[model samples]
Target: MKIAVIDAQGAGLGQTIIKKIRKEIEKDIYIIALGTNTFATSNMVKAGANVGISGERAISSFCRTNKIDGIIGPIGVMCSGSINGEITPLISKSIFNMECTKYILPLQKHGIYIPGTRNLQIKDIIEEIVFDIKNNLVLIS
Candidate 1:
């Protein structure tokens, strides 16, 4: 299966997800990195993603076509329209409106507040993602 790891300007989270996927799933799978920019995409690619797509245009196009089996990242990746720097409305709408499956972390959920996240390790995020995805696979079958 193909999985898209979507992320904000920081690719660390996407990399964490890739690491988790590698350790958990033995089957052949494709990791598509959809970054908010080139830096984020490159980081994820270095981590493990087979392919990386960056830039606002690329993100919107990818989402529009629904080319990925699933996505993982922060909801802020979908926030747009002058709300924050580089958060365009088109990309935001595409991400939020898209119907693709996601392996969103608990702290990344919409309207969910996570306190004192300064020291949260990447491994912790990976573990949660792995657990969630494994559960999802079982439930779907």
Candidate 2:
């Protein structure tokens, strides 16, 4: 299975998500780290992402052309000017257009809060993302 972990800023969340996927999933999954900046991409690459792409054009281009099974990232990924203005309109549009399931982390900083997700730790959220991916694989297979 192929999946994308999108992030911006320092990409700490992306790195964490990638690491969990590597640990929790035994399948030979291909991970793509889609970051809004070089630093963010590099961090996820160091965390074992199979491939890393940085910058808005590269991210949007990959998203438009690739066929991914799933995408995990902050809720801001689907919003323009999100991630402290790092998320571009094209990126948001591309993510929205992709034919895949999206696993959004409802981080309060994004300002589009989801009720009942509050008080959950980042580690827990990452686990949920991995669990969902595993469940999805069973359904698809």
Candidate 3:
């Protein structure tokens, strides 16, 4: 299975997700770290992603052309002008257009809200994502 963990800024969230996925997923999964900047990408790579790519064009093009089985990231990744505009419009559109299962973290920092998810903590959300991937995508793909 192949998964892409997308993040911006310092990539703390992406790093966390990669670490959890590595620890939880027993299958031989390939992880791609997509970050809006160098620092973010490097941090996720350090967190054990198989490969890391940064910047708008590279990330957007890769998402548009790659065969990623799953895409994981905060809600900001889908919104243009998110993360103080670090997530470019191309990046958002490319991710949305990708033909893959996407597990988006309901992070309100992007000013977007998902009802019923507001009460869930980050740890809970991460756990749910990891569980879903392991139980569903991993087994099927």
Candidate 4:
């Protein structure tokens, strides 16, 4: 499965998701780190993502062309409006609107415009995702 992780300015949340995924699932999964900026993407790559793309054009183009299985990031990942206009909405819209199953963290005030999927802690969300994947796989077999 190809899981695209979007990070704006390397809040370090994206890396946490990748680490949990690797520990929980045995299947081969590809992580495509899409950073709203260079810093975000670089951190994700160091955290074990196979590929990393930074900048607006690359991020937009990749999301438009590819079909990612899932996406994990803060809700601000959708709007792109940051504190000082660092991460713009264009980058966020590209990934959020793309055809991918989304598991977004609630980070609205922190520059993520997350409307739904709120009030949940990061650890709880990650646990849910890992449990769901494992349960589904077991049922299938």
Candidate 5:
């Protein structure tokens, strides 16, 4: 399976998610790290993503053409003008239009609050995400 992990800004969250997923999933799943900037992509790559790419066009084009099985990122990924206005319209549109399962981390700092997820820590949230992917794989198989 191929999964894309998209992030921006400092990429701390994306790095954490990549590390956790690598530890939890023993299978040879390809993890692509897509970032809004070079710093973000570099951090995720250091965290063990199979491949890393940056910039608006790179992200949009890859999502538009790639056969990604799943995508994981903050809620800002789907919101145009989100992530301190770093998420462009094209990036948001491409991500939203992609035919893949999406796992969004609920971060209230972006002004996009997910109900019932207010108190969860980032680690717990990532654990849930990994669990969901594992369960989905079982179902698919």
Candidate 6:
């Protein structure tokens, strides 16, 4: 299975997600790291993503042409004017319009909050996400 982990800025969240996913899921899977900048992409790559890409145009173009089975990222990825405006309208539109499941971390920024969510640590949230992916998604390997 192929999963795209999108992030911006520092990409610490994306790196953590990749590491946990690798540790938890024994099955062979391809993780693609999509970042809004070089720092983010390189960080994710160092964390063991199979491949990494950066920039708004690259992200938009890849999402348009590639077959991404799933997408995981902060809620900012889907919100235009998010991540300090790093996520463009095209990127948001492409991600939202893609025919793939999205596992979004309910991170509140820029006055956006995911209602009813507890103030869980990043590790706890990632564990839940990894568990959900393992239980809910079918992997072909």
> How high a TM-score does candidate 1 get?
0.75
Tens digit of per-residue lDDT, candidate 3, span 1-141: 899999999999999999999998845789999999999999999999999999999998898779978999999999998998998899999999999999999887755778898789999999999988888764776
The lDDT of each candidate is: 0.73, 0.91, 0.92, 0.75, 0.91, 0.88
Candidate 5: C-alpha lDDT: 0.91
Best by lDDT: 3
Task: Report the C-alpha displacement of residue 23, candidate 2, in angstroms.
Answer: 0.8
Write the residue-wise lDDT of candidate 2 on 20-126 in tens digits.
89888857689999999999999999998999999999998998898999999998998999889999999999999999999988888765778898899888988
Instruction: Encode model 4's per-residue lDDT on 1-141: one tens digit a residue.
Output: 678887776548888877787788747677888887788888888888889998889988998999877777766666556534655777777876888678766654763444555676788888887676566556646
| Model 6 worst lDDT run, 10 consecutive residues | 132-141
Please write out the lDDT profile of model 5 over residues 1-141, one tens digit for every residue: 888999999899999999998899867678999999999999999999999999999999999889988999999998999987879999999999999999988888665667898789888989999998888777766
Of the candidates numbered 2 and 6, which has the greater TM-score value? 2
State candidate 3's TM-score. 0.95
Among all windows of ten consecutive residues in candidate 5, which has the lowest summed lDDT? 105-114
- Ten contiguous residues minimizing lDDT sum, candidate 3: 132-141
Q: How many residue pairs clash in model 1?
A: 0
Candidate 1 residue pairs in clash (backbone atoms < 3 Å): none
Pairs in steric clash, model 6 = none
Give each prediction's root-mean-square deviation over alpha carbons.
Answer: 3.9, 1.3, 1.2, 3.0, 1.3, 1.6
lDDT of 1 by residue, 16-68 (tens): 78877877874567788988788888999988889999988998898888666
lDDT of 4: 0.75
* Cα-based lDDT at residue 23, candidate 2: 88
Q: Which stretches of model 4 miss by more than 4 angstroms? A: 108-119, 133-141
lDDT of 3 at 63: 88
- Name the lDDT of candidate 6: 0.88
TM-score of each: 0.75, 0.94, 0.95, 0.81, 0.93, 0.92
